[model samples]
Target: MTKITLNAEARSDLGKGASRRLRRNANLVPAVVYGGDKAPQSISLLAKDFAKALENEATFSSVISLTIDGKAEDVVIKALQRHPAKSFVLHADFVRVVAGQKMTTSVPLHFINAENSVGVKQQGGEVSHVISEVEVSCEAKDLPEFIEVDLSNVEVGQILHLSDLKLPKGVQLVALAHGNNLAVANIHASRAE
Candidate 1:
């Protein structure tokens, strides 16, 4: 898994107005880090830096080391609020990650060999992704950046479910724990249009 380090500062000021000032005047993004049995911390980060990090696909699932006032905490992006009309970040929520403890988080799914899949290439079918991401539980150290779904052998009218995914050795899908075998992807005949 890819690890990211984000530099932040402990913010003493609170309230929506303070957050607005941080974003408008200081050009920083306000965020909170909670969970992992530790007290929540309010912090601010460089908006540009946070935006740059958000550009990386791996940032969502990857563990981020947040450095605040010389102290570092391991965290993952729990939620992010963006501006309504613009592409600017409004606020962010991060969850602390404790080592040796299992945590659930969503990871992107990568469909490989789709172009060469039997359903698409041989049968002239189209591949449709029912879900782009899946939630999984695993120790912080065993967390995977993304899950890979191979469609090379999938035939037309075939549907691949969550159980079909090949997860890392130490990882388990959250959906399976509750007996939900969600559809991940499928290949079917293209429309007549």
Candidate 2:
């Protein structure tokens, strides 16, 4: 709930050709907002503003206040298509945040105390991150900025799965709930000569 807001305008032009023209002519990014009880709406946002808003990593998981033509609504970023060779975003997809409803979004994982962990500091082990982010299901209010994985207690040859990390209240890992039990990080013996 970081009061981040992006100003947007409804776009009537549809299809791939129109989207290309919009990007080339006006430097606007085409986006769509779907989900909840309302029908999907096509919109356009300023390229610079869109890029600026996404500069913060938390913006991807936190609830965003999207202002469209003076009207405001809460949303969560679902997907983003970036240019293959460029750093700019080409298209964006968002899901409308409905009160009392669960929304699934990806949040970054923060590994703490890796350098001073039992594996690295005491056992000459190196940490390997298998995944950097995880998809979670929770209400907008329960959405976490990032999940923290503590490596201080970990030992060499230990692979911490998604369920090993402590999640916040009202937050649940989507993969864990489905029995995926993905490995988030691990500590292994150093291969350096």
Model 1 misplaced regions, further than 4 Å = none
| Cα lDDT tens digits for candidate 1, 61-159 | 999999999998999999999999997999999999998999999999999999999999999999999999999999989889999999999999999
The backbone clash count of each candidate, in order, is 0, 0
Q: Which candidate wins on TM-score?
A: 1
How many Å off is the CA of 116 in candidate 2? 0.5
Query: How high is the CA lDDT of each candidate model?
Result: 0.95, 0.93
Q: Find the candidate with the highest lDDT and give its number.
A: 1
Q: Every model's Cα RMSD, please?
A: 0.8, 1.0
lDDT tens per residue, model 2, 50-159: 89988999899888999988999899898999999997899999899999988889999999999999999999999999999999999889999999999999999999
What TM-score would candidate 2 get against the native? 0.97
